[model samples]
Target chain A: MTIKLDRPDERGRFGEFGGRFAPETLMPALEELETAFAEAWSDPEFRTEFSEILTTYIGRPTPLHPARSLSEHLGVEVLLKREDLAHTGAHKINNAIGQGLLARRMGKPRVIAETGAGQHGVATATAAAYFGLDCTVYMGEVDIERQALNVLRMEILGAEVVAVRTGAGTLKDAVSEAMRDWVRTVEDTHYVIGSVVGPHPFPWMVREFQRVIGEEVLGQMGDDLPDVVVACVGGGSNAMGIFHPLAERGIELVGIEAAGEGIDTGRHGASIGAGTPGVLHGSATYLLQDEQGRVREAHSISAGLDYPGVGPEHAYFHQTGLARYESVTDDEALEGVELLARTEGIIPALESAHAIAWVARERRRLEGRRVLVNLSGRGDKDVEEIGKRR
Target chain B: MGRERLSSLFARTRAEGRAVLLPYMTAGLPDPGTSLALFEAMAGAGADGFEVGIPYTDPLMDGPVIQQGSERAIEAGTSPDVALELVAAVVESTGLPVLVMTYANPILHRGVDEFVAVAAEAGADGVIVPDLPVEESGPLRRAADRHGLGVVQFVAPTSGTARIEAVAAADPCFVYAVAEMGVTGERAEAGGRLDGLVGRIRAVTDVPVVAGVGISTPSQAAAAARVADGVIVGSALVRRVLEADSPDAATSELAQAVADLAAAVR
Candidate 1:
């Protein structure tokens, strides 16, 4: 198999996993966006400007650092892709800047996004501020409490943060609220979706934007391919970015899902490993749903990983055997956070620590081999919440 | 039982020189008993047709009012079975054309063909799935047609000519014309594109067209009904019923409000 996944095939479907499951009112807007993005991608001027901005402003080609201490401890050559070094302190800025530019190109003066852990919110706010566009981010009320510093950072960056108080008051509800906002304000506003979820174009488009990570890794790694590549899967954007370009190039692609308390307890966010395919938030992906097909609330210590649905592409990858998915418990991920801080002097976001936790699980098997891990965001925003976990 | 009843209702309303008044109520909301009473009260009040919503856990396209009603229904254990029973009871009591307006996931979970058969057997006249667009509606539409259940399709103000054609091709009993680019809610007035969209839809099909979303006040409904065949009042009626102190009070107040709403459209 060439790993040729011709998905979203004019109907936004990845082998029936993804489609535009939105309301009638949003259909035209989504169509308009699809057309605009295609045109932007083809236009030389547009590509040049977007690339220049990504390189100079958002800080591209985030370094691939050799984690010597982690390597010695794990007995494998563990290298960390420092997305934490990006300007907004996470890899989310890559897509945010791309969308901000796309918003401008489409003559949309306002942009709105939904955030879980607030990294995407801050990145969006920062990009919107730089580009002189009005920005608003919808965050769940619970997340607003859990990630207070990020909310403050968004405010300071001049983006309006609306607290969504629906459902479980988490990422899922925040995205729903943002969709509601867009339905009411679609004429001049662009819905800058945070992750690779939602309707058509988002999963495909977000992957295209984040593909820079994998492309850079291929160049940095020189002639040899790593034996393993690992990244945490929340909505799976960061993982998709690193995994897509290197898809056909044979390397073990592993995605770590958050197993909040445990999968058996039905409290985890491991949608793929333990979920059925269903439509939610504009996409038909793997979802935690009841027999009545109502979306079940997901829980995780890390707000970013606490969602009931995964991206559609990740579902395809799982089915095609292109990637293997595993779950890490909240306790295990926290331990990974502690281990990385102590050994490598790097504090990773709890979302990223899920990948670090994978290393601990496969230390013996991965010995004498090289592995690449996407360290998605810094753990600075998580310190306060981590402190309270005790 | 489905489209024929709806056809007769509209024909009668048309002969009377008044637009049909389709009122939406969230099923099993505020407890099943009250929800049942509210439907009967609405039928007696002057509703030409009824659109009953099966409350889902996530009603992404709903406004605050309907969302509140849906959450209440969900909390009160209004699953698909419960909602179907509610639909049956409403139809048995009212003897009026009643349509089930719900999201697609529930039906998809139950098996589309099975769901349509069950809904028809339960006395639902028709169904309106907001998220299932015409392109992805082949299976459900075929099942609905086989069961004589009208599968209502929608055309939004933002829809292009091709989509308008596709929706027309779906040949719904009535084209659900979205009056605005937003979720179901009470607004000061409807969007300004009702005439344009209704006119475009009329050019394609002879199906009856009903405008919904943001048409709240009696005057707003009348204004919108001028260009369209009928109007569906959602958040406003749902809001009024929610505000009444008692179910009996709710019955009278809601019935009176629906009558007033009927008169304005007339």
Candidate 2:
């Protein structure tokens, strides 16, 4: 089955999903930003400037290394897209820099962001410092406790960190707080949404920024494309980044979700497999919720993967049969970290481990074929948690 | 208690040279039983309208005060069924028109027709979905219309004239003018942008326009009522219920607060 792929419609819909579901107060701002992004994207100078910064500042074109040992072990030539090598130790910096530039260009002197695992917070802070834009990061109190090092990194880089204590005090709540801040301060502030979720233009604009991941891969490959590409899905930004350029490629694209305990145990972050489509955090997408429609708290060892919803584009892909989804348990993800560390001498973030585990499980089918995995982030932030597990 | 009945209340207020006084509260805040009693008391205290909230696990548009109230209510087991029951009881007790203020997921999950039928059966006059934009509200609006229920649409201070026209086409009992740029919260002064929004809304729709979201004080209510046909106060009086020492005290205090705002709207 072929999936018909194109840009979002004028209303910013990916098929029947994704629209501006925010309060009316935010509608005018969204329209304004949408227009600005279109104009910027069309400008040749903007593209050249963005590319120059990615190359010089963010350390882009991260190597696509062939994992020889892991390949020999699995009987497949497994390739790794080393996004972990990016300046902020994650792929988040790529999108943050683009948005930070846009914010500055729009003359919004201040920027705000929400982070779950703190990778986005650090990335935004780094970009804000680069552009000399005033920055504030809203983090869940629970996340601040888990990812304390990142919080310190953001603060030392000149961004104010606020601990959000409302609701479940997780990524969802943090995004809510950031949006509330944006509503009042929008006159001079730009909300740097860290994911391909929330209202329109956001999901669309974030994809536009992150598509560089796939574009770079295709450009570097020249002729031969991988038989399969894999990335873990939280809000699915990185996955969409890689998959979108390859969506019409007709190759296999696997997005691994976190099955915290197990899918059947109802303690997982697999929104596409086990959730219904509805609105949350201002965008209509697949969400984990109860029969009464109260969104349930998602669980994962990786703070970044513990979210109740996936990006609407992922939902669109799922509906169109363009991309297939699989899930890996926390135990399997931990084992994935160990195997990659031992074999490739490369440490993976707990969130990225899920993708690594999926490749391991599906290795037999991919034997002697080329595959790519989005190594989204480094393991430095999760070493303490992994140590505790051991 | 339906749209026609709700319309008459607004008509009476307009003819009296005043705006309707709408008081909002979470269903099971400070507990369910007392919340119902407080609604009855507010009606007696001269409230012209009500917006009853259904507690959800996630309230993206709510500020800390209402979030706390919703969390408490959810802990007290105010599910969709329970919330509908409370609506029914409020209708029976106060005989005042009520609108259920909620996010979109609950209605979508319950099957729009089923939820609308239940709410209509429970005597709800209208529904206000903060996250359901006018463009995507067709299915729910159709179901609500079938049940003779009005679906209220909100006009934001930042809304352009085109959006104002679109919201006006939703055919609400009244256009709820969001008095500020942010989520539901208490503010000392009504937003400076609110009057401009109300005037723009008046140009689009013939229905009454009600100012809401940040009008916390009696003076703020008075200020907002000058440019609109009514005012709706949430976070303010709900905070009073949270602070009162007892449920009886909450009822009396809330009633007093509603009365003060009601008198000010005139």
Candidate 3:
């Protein structure tokens, strides 16, 4: 059966917010993604090969661990989808592997991608090494300074990292710089968008690739659909992936956005919850922009969640009420970070911590019910930031 | 005169065997107030029309020099409203036909109807959104007409016959025939294919055609004048303005560049 979860323009957004608003140079890439994904998603051979790689190479079918201590603390049965155990230590690798394979199949000689918190960059570089393709990653100058270890990891994996220094000097700028590179070398290059953001098929395609998280979680749960599935929404990739399959399962999918201080404080990355529809880096989505359309800076303690715009699908889902979005402040997310590390021995990425914080705070309402939280990535990359906060 | 009136002026110029001199500049670059002085200088230098570039974060079609000017404008806090105010100041001072040249995002951000109304209020005669092609210009065109603003359209050398026809049909002013496939900036040499492109666009429309993109020197302007009715100088003027010892000096140097090109085009 065809899945309506990944349909483009549903609620006219991804999740509730994603649409194509990209430069003309990337249109062909988006079109290719639409065609290839449509074909591969239907082909049993493609599915089998993809599943084989995920299971063997990426260590898929990660366990659904019942965090008894955390459940008791929160007064709800909180189950963690152990994505932290996945190859590369994050859910980012799933989409990266899929896009990397798609790039090779499309006969691209090089792969270019943008990364914000460096997780996606590391994941993409790993895929490039695995696929034996020349890879380059564009990262913001600030991100390189903050996430030096991941930058080194990307370089060690044989991917060249270019520092982008324009337009707030962050992920958006990296995306812009990547587009410039793609325009010059579109014939031989494939741009593997790191998240479920950007225009058109990317939001849909990346989510489909990530849906394995939800599929596996549901299978492992076995007749016990959770009351709510919580995932961090940094560009909404992990959230979309974990939520897409559960939409029809009669479970509430809550996407937690980063509220740097508080959403009301006007210093947050809660684009879907607070921003307006504006075009940035090519795709029109919910973005934080001034009255004149200049993109505003977004802030979050989690570098990964500090994006001003959200994926189109998230925008759609939010608009149509397919999913619910809530904001978690830096303090709350950090509290969640500390709680998870202490209780479950799994230090979650701050982006993921936002979702954990939401689950911890709201689990009282979900008493006597099961909750699945997508543990998006390990906290190794966020150690320095966490230490600084401490 | 309004943009439609300005288009008629160019049409009359074409009929009378006179070539238009379209000078381009980034609005509020260096400073918002100084842009007015530069406009006055260009008008004194005998520019027949002006293309005011609205500063944008990513100028995909701009060469290094024009790109720097756009960056400077943005640094100086030039927004769409600032650009419109500058254009109004120029039109109020010079009475020259002014076209707002910008990417589509700023226009979209400004709200199409409000943007057109603001440009018209600022005394802009027309607008040329380079990124918005003929196919996607319906809303902008309708808005421009509603506000009595002319919609200036571009025809690239690489465009096919169908594109040329589409551009001609939507264009309300002289067709801007890009001299090359790349962005606006300084080139070591003017393009080699202008004559063919101008001839091709001329075949598609009765409107006057002006060549832009790489026409930097007087000789390039003269070469462009061989087939087109006007030559637009953007990067050359912007470079002079950016390198001037001061904004005043930049205006003088830009005036000289405009005069040299105007003489060649004439």
Model 2 pairs in collision: none
Predicted structure with the largest DockQ when compared to the true one: 1
TM-scores, in order shown?
A: 0.98, 0.98, 0.87
Docking class for candidate 2: medium
Give a tens-digit lDDT track for model 3, residues B1-266. 56667868677777878688888899996688688899999999989878899887766556668768888998898888888889888888888888888876677777889888888888888888765656456889999888888887777655667767877878657787878645666777876988898889878888878888888999988888878888888888888988889987898888888888888887
What DockQ does candidate 2 have relative to the true complex?
A: 0.76
The residue-by-residue lDDT of candidate 2 on B1-110, one tens digit each, is 57887889888988999988989899987897677888988998889878999998777778888988898899988887898899999998888899998888898888
Q: Tens digits of per-residue lDDT for model 1 on A1-390?
A: 345554468988887778888888888899899999888878899889978988898678889999999889888899999998999889999999989999999999999999999999999999899899999999999999999999999999999999999888999999999999999899999999989999998998888888889889999987787889999999999999999988877899999999999999999999998988888888888989998888899999999999999999999899889998999999999999999999989999999999999998889999888899999999999999888875
In terms of lDDT, the best-performing candidate is: 1
After superposition, candidate 2 runs with Cα above 4 Å error: none
- Return the TM-scores of chain A for each candidate in numbered order: 0.98, 0.98, 0.95
**lDDT per residue as tens, model 3, A158-191:** 9999997766668877876777677556668888
Q: What value does the lDDT take at residue A108 in candidate 1? A: 94
Per-model interface RMSD values are: 1.0, 1.3, 4.5
Give Cα distance to truth, residue A389, candidate 1, Å.
1.6
**All candidates in order of DockQ, best leading:** 1, 2, 3
Which regions of candidate 1 are displaced past 4 Å?
Answer: A1-3
User: Which rank order by lDDT, best down to worst?
Assistant: 1, 2, 3
Provide C-alpha RMSD values for all models, in order. 1.4, 1.4, 3.9
Error of 2 at A35 (Å): 1.1
